[model samples]
Target: MIKIALFNHKGGVGKTTLTVNIADALADLEKSVLIVDADPQCNITSFYMDESRLEELLGESGEDGSDATVWSALKPVVEGRGDVGSITPWEMRKGIHLLPGDVLMSDYEEELPTAWTECFARRQRGYSVTTALSRLVNNNAESLEVDVVLYDVGPNVGALNRVVILDCDLFITPVAADLFSLRALSTVGRSVAKWIADWQTIRSLASPADRESIFEGLPTYGGYITSAFKVHTGRSAANPHADWEKKIAPRVRDRVVSVLGAVNPDLIPNFGGNKVGGVKHFHSLAPEAQKYGFAIGKLRGYVNPGHYATVDDARSTFAALAREIVRRAGI
Candidate 1:
């Protein structure tokens, strides 16, 4: 199964929105998809799951060993008990499941880095600590026949993200049309390069058999999606105005190629093809969909006819994005 992380070290770039909506679109296409909310904030989990149910799975009274979150599967490894045991993902639908997120996940930030150092010693704790998520997904994917695994991570270069990034097969970045996003391109690019190099160095010290114990190398740059490009007002539909894509698109192309090309020149992103469609601001439809747990595209007549166009726009845009991601990531 192909694993893709929808990440950006910048907030408000529609990262979780794209993860939730695009995965919904992929499920619409009959693909078995699993969304792992790696973000400690658990916004993606809240999007697809009921708050009460989520609380029961992560609350104090519910913090028993039976809790089924990404954090639950890592608790043993983080405590240096042993390898990760079977991960029981919460079923969301027929083909879509959720390995929910917990607020307590932040506790692993310090633990993972310490484990990384121990990994060079070929200790089982290090292997279990570093490979918990990968082992969970890999073990589940084969039996579940999952087509794709999508991850939603918070916007940061933290220790928890390091483990997630190192384990994935590919990463799909979501950025906005702004200077901050342009700057984050550098942050993500350099950090990923350093992580990959450091992991390789650690693996080099291990014997041949133990070398395979390291988590998968840093995920390849799958592509980028530029969100919040156009500012929508009541009259935007009547009179179209210039969007940020024109000014920011070239910079995105240049920065991605310059930073990531050093590793794989052929994988340099092409703006024309790699650019997923600019997602339209769905305004009220998004919050409404989240409230009712409906896919923005399929939000049935919960609103007036006037807002139908926006819902349709959100539906079509994410559907196109889902297809683009599948093609680019080769899922």
Candidate 2:
């Protein structure tokens, strides 16, 4: 399976929304998809199920001594009890599965920093701790036999996210048209470069056996997706939102593509451009899709006639984005 993470160092960039709808679109294309909710906020979990169902999953352990959440699977390793345990993902749709997120996952953040330090010494326990999430994801993906695994991570450059990013085969940044999001590209670029270099050093320190056991190498830069930008009826240069889009594109090229490419040109694909796709503001249709627990295109019987066009647009937009991702990633 090709593992792709939708991430950004800045919050409110529509990462959760893109992760959900893109998975939905991929399912429509007959690809079995597994979404790993690595974010401690559990926003993607909320999108797939209601509060009562989420409570049941997170509140108590299963008969098999698991809660079927990301934290539950990694809890054993974090506490030094054992390695990651088996997790059963929830089938959100015909071809879509969700490995629900846990609010308690924030607890794992404290363990990663120490584990990362010990990795330089080639300690088995340290490697196990650091690769806990990766092992959990890979095992579950194999069991499900899914075509792709999409990760939704929180907005930060924390130690927890460092491991998550390193575990992936590729990652995409979801950005909004604003100065804050623009500036975050620099942080994302620099942090990823450092993480990849450090991971390479750690790999060099490991014995061949340890290296073989823990060797899911560095992730490459897939591309960036422009999201939550205002849609104007007319494509005029005078429009402020259009102006921001114009400005952000070159900066994305300079900050993200060039920086990562400089580190290792192979980290970026030879695709003509780095923009995978874009999503316009969905307005009320976005909330309706979330409330109904369906992609905008999948919502039926609950949407008003007035929003039909918006739904159609959203469906087509996501479908095209999914196709581009498949082509670009060679999935």
Candidate 3:
């Protein structure tokens, strides 16, 4: 199975929106999928549930249930016990299952120092933070019926983000067409670089060559996906570009592209390459997505052909990105 994560160190970059729609797009193609909401914001989780259900789930996301959330799912396995799958496949749609998150999930941050302590504990083999998360996903998940697992993560490099980054196989970056989000591309690249290095550092010290066998390899991030992309005619784009994307994209495709290529050329090639991967852009189908409280991709009519002809084109873009992922995973 492919475990894909949607993350950006920068906030307001449409990370959650891309995660939801991509899952829908994949489901349209009949691909079985799992979406884990690791973001304390739980925006993705609320989107998947009805009103009352959302309220209840949000209540559950508090300190009272943080342990029962995805964090608990990854706890070290007891001698004879197993991890719990908080998700019920049958209760989920035929092709999709969701592990929800919420706003009150901030306790995960408070719990990090304890985790740092555990990592240094010499408690047991694979008891490190990385292994704890690995064990959680592997143990708690009863069974996965799909080929892809998507994680909607928050914007940061703290405990959960670190663990999720280590556990994911593909990183789908969603950035606004603004400056701050674009500038964030550089931070994301650096974070990925460090993550890859650190994973190797830990793996090298292990006794067996396949010590990291329990976890997936740290693949270079999938190319960034631009959200709220307005018309590209250069006429202010009706709004030039968002503040975040403007500062970030160039650093990603320009400065870091070559270095990333040296490390994993297949993941992020030259922007205009023949490979199934390269930098690509996507805009919001409506004016609302660019401003306002909702994303156009979330609207029910979003799938209608007229509303998203670009989706057809973007699908090819992401499909290539997906192909790059499969190729790297040796699938």
Better of 1 and 2 by TM-score: 2
- Give the per-residue lDDT digits (tens) of candidate 3, residues 1-331: 7778867787876667666556655665567777777787777766656668766644553332244355434332321134333433223455777776655445545554455344344333333434554554554344765667777888887766876777877666666655566666677777676666655555555446446453544665555566653223354455465434455456666644655566566655343432223333454443333332233434435455565656456555555544554554433
Q: Write the per-residue lDDT of candidate 1 for residues 174-207, one digit (tens) a residue.
A: 8776657757877887787777777877777777
Q: Estimate each model's TM-score.
A: 0.89, 0.95, 0.70
For TM-score, the strongest prediction is: 2
Candidate number that wins on TM-score, 1 or 3: 1
Off by over 4 Å in 3: 58-68, 71-92, 103-105, 113-129, 139-142, 209-217, 229-239, 242-250, 259-331
Poorest 10 consecutive residues of model 1 by lDDT? 232-241
Which segments of candidate 2 are over 4 A away from where they belong?
A: 61-64, 229-238
lDDT of each: 0.75, 0.86, 0.56
| lDDT, candidate 2, at 180 | 80
What is the C-alpha lDDT profile of model 2 across 52-109, one tens digit per residue? 9998988863334685699888888888988888887999989999999988788888
In the predicted model 2, the residue pairs found to clash are none
- For model 3, what is the error of residue 215's alpha carbon versus the real structure, in angstroms, after optimal superposition? 2.4
Which candidate comes out best when scored by lDDT? Answer: 2
